[model samples]
Target: MTDKRDFAHIETWVFDLDNTLYPHHVNLWQQVDARIGDFVATYLKVTPDEAFKIQKDYYRRYGTTMRGMMTEHGVRADDYLKYVHAIDHSPLEPNPAMGAAIERLPGRKLILTNGSCEHASNVLARLGIADHFEAVFDIIAAELEPKPSPQTYRRFLDLHNVDPTKAAMFEDLARNLVVPHDLGMTTVLVVPDGVKDVVREDWELEGRDAGHVDHVTDDLTGFLQGLLAKG
Candidate 1:
């Protein structure tokens, strides 16, 4: 691990919502994934298999499936977001330990996600850590733009009045950290534990060099705890 003191100047903590905050094994995103596939299948009159391919293709091309759908097919963003996020959040167990770790961190905490604010709110509430964050910057807030897009990052920083040099961003996808790293923020990649055999999409895989990532950790709570200890 890089010395935690390296992050000593981070006065703002920006976190991605889905797999970064919750373990991937919890499969919370599976519900949203299936819903996206179903939406694509229904809208395009294609089989689920074909829709799955299209979903991923759009995700790769547009940073998000919804953005691709809107750009190509004129899909309504609000309805699509509501439909895809309408899933049971019961898989996310309340995490007091994680909450405590987050609380111990010094800084303004913000959730930066490509998902809807309502979805972020639901997930935070399910985790029992709703009150920990100062604000959530969601897809709508980004004007339908998504991460890995420099424009989205720029807007987020402007909306929150955050200085990238004084921020640390944690995300499950390494690609999403590229802009943050370029902006001078400390970037941490959060991967699932014991993921040797787990299948992931191309975008989910970390690059060989992973030069954009300053740190890697499987346990976000533990990582935060260590940061506090070192601080």
Candidate 2:
């Protein structure tokens, strides 16, 4: 763990809502991931395998698969978001420890996600930590833009009136932390802890040593609690 003193200046704790907040071991996002592929396959009338290729391609090229489709094929963003996020969230049990850890933070909390607003809401509600965050900045809020893009991060910072120098961002994807780091926010990469039992992409596991990440943790709740302890 990085010294908690490193986080003493942080006044805004920004978090990504997916695998970052909740442990990815639960595989809640795998359902959404599958749904994305399902949406792509059906919408494009292609095989599932082909959809898989396209989904990864679009995600790598355009920040999000839906955004790629929107840019190239004029796909309806609303339809795509709704369809892909239509998953049962009952598997997400509440983590009171995490709630307590978050509640003990020194300042405001916000969620910045590439996912939809409703999806972020559902996940937080299911985790029983919805009330901790001040607001959620979703894809639509970014005007259908996704993270790793400097523009989208700027929009979120402006919308929330956040000072990047005093903020800290936590995300599961290493690539998503780049712009935040560049903009002077302390960047944290939340990893999967070598739990290969869950569905995940190899590329998703890349880039911890690329220097954009200031801290990395496989156990978010524990990490947060440790921060408090050290602080």
Score every model by TM-score. 0.95, 0.96
- Assess candidate 1 and give its lDDT: 0.90
Question: Number of clashes in model 2?
Answer: 0
Q: What is the TM-score of candidate 2?
A: 0.96
Worst 10 residues of 2 by lDDT: 1-10
Writing each residue's lDDT as its tens digit, candidate 1 over 1-231 gives 443326888899999999989987887888998999999999999999999989999999999999999999999999899999999999799999999988878989999999999999999999999899999999999999899899999999999999999999999999899899889999898987875344467658665247788888888999999988888
| Model 2 pairs in collision | none
Which regions in candidate 2 have their CA more than 4 angstroms from the true location?
1-5
| 1-231: candidate 2 lDDT, tens digit per residue | 443326989999999998999888889988988999999899899999999999989999999999898988889998998899999999999999999999999999999999988999999988889999999999999998898889999999999999999999999999998889888899888998785576778888888776788888999999999999989
